[model samples]
Every structure is written in C-alpha cells, then in structure tokens.
Target: MNWIILVIAGLFEVAFTSCLGKAKTTTGNEAYWWYAAFALTCGTSMFLLIKSTETLPLGTAYAVWTGIGAVGTVLMGIFFFHDPATFWRMFFIATLIMSIVGLKLVSAH
Candidate 1:
C-alpha cells in the first residue's frame, strides 16, 4: 500500500540521516563509504516517496513522510548517538507525534 511505502521511505530517511552523522565523524575511506551509503539510502527513500505520491495527496504524503522521518531520526539520535533527552525535547517530539497521527486520521486514505 502507499501508506506502507511511505513509512518505509521515512525509515530510509532516518537511516540515511544516521549515516550522514556517522560520515561526519570519519576520515578517508570510511568517510567515503558512509557518504556513499547516505547517497544510496537517500535515493531509495526519495524513490519510495515519489511512488507514494502517485496515490496520496502531495502535501499529505510529504508531511507524513517527513514527520515520520523526523521523529525516527530524533529517536535514533537519542538512543544510538546518546544525544541528550531533555524534557522539552521529548515533549516536543511527543507533540510532533500527535500531530502526525492527527494528520493521518484526517487524511482520506
């Protein structure tokens, strides 16, 4: 389904973002590899997003996709990168999540 594809694309967005972060910390060959991975993953994510847009409204699809990616990337940062999980950060993340759910519910699937 388009929704499933969108979700997968969002997940790939998270993966590519994480890879980008990792790339920033490396040197030479390792950095190049990470950059390549980032490029590939980003391409795949975009392709899936384009596919989903064929069925979903452009605005709805884009917002939902980016919303999912943003949430997932933040969580990945907190968990894998050991980034700070301040109360306000978590609160806003929850708020974003609620908004995402609201959008999904209101969207004519």
Candidate 2:
C-alpha cells in the first residue's frame, strides 16, 4: 500500500536526520560514515516519497510525511541526542501526532 510506503519513507527521513545528528557530534572517519549513511537514507526516503505520491494526494502525503519525520526526529532528539523534553515540547508533539492521524482518517485513499 502507498500509505505503508509513505510511512517507510518517513522513517527513512528520521534515520537520515539521526545520521546527521551523529555526524555533527563526531570526528574524522566516523563523521564521514554517518554522512554517507545520511546521503543513502535521504535518497531512499525521497525515492519512496516519490513512489507513494504516484497514488497519494501530494498535499496530504507531504504533510503526513513531514509530520512523521518531525515527530520521529523530535523523539530521537529527546531519547538519543539528549535534547530537552519540556512539557510544551511534548504537548506539541502529541498534537502533531493527533493531526497526522486526523489527516490519515480523512484521506480518501
């Protein structure tokens, strides 16, 4: 299903972002490896997004994709990157999750 593909693409987006974060924190060959992973995952995410968009409404699909990426990246930041998990930040993330669900429910696919 296109939705599944879209979700996978979004996950790849998360992975690419995580790779970027790792790259930022490291040095030399380790950083280069993370950057390489970032490129690979980013390309895969884009490819999957394009494939899903063939059957999905562009606006809805893009919003959902970015929403998934944003939520996932934020969670990764909190859990792995030692970013702050303030109440308001968590509240907004929850709202983003709800909005993503709402979009899926209303989609005509």
Clash count list over all predictions: 0, 0
Q: What does candidate 2's lDDT look like per residue over 1-109, in tens digits?
A: 9999999999999999999999999999999999999999999999999999998999999999999999999999999999999999999999999999999999999
Name the regions of candidate 2 deviating beyond 4 angstroms: none
Question: lDDT of each prediction vs. the true structure?
Answer: 0.94, 0.98
Q: In angstroms, how far off is 99's CA in candidate 2? A: 0.5
For residues 69-107, write the lDDT of model 1, one tens digit per residue: 999999999999999999999999999999889988998
Which residue segments of model 1 deviate by more than 4 Å? none
Best by lDDT: 2
TM-score for candidate 2, residues paired by index: 0.99
Most TM-score-accurate candidate: 2
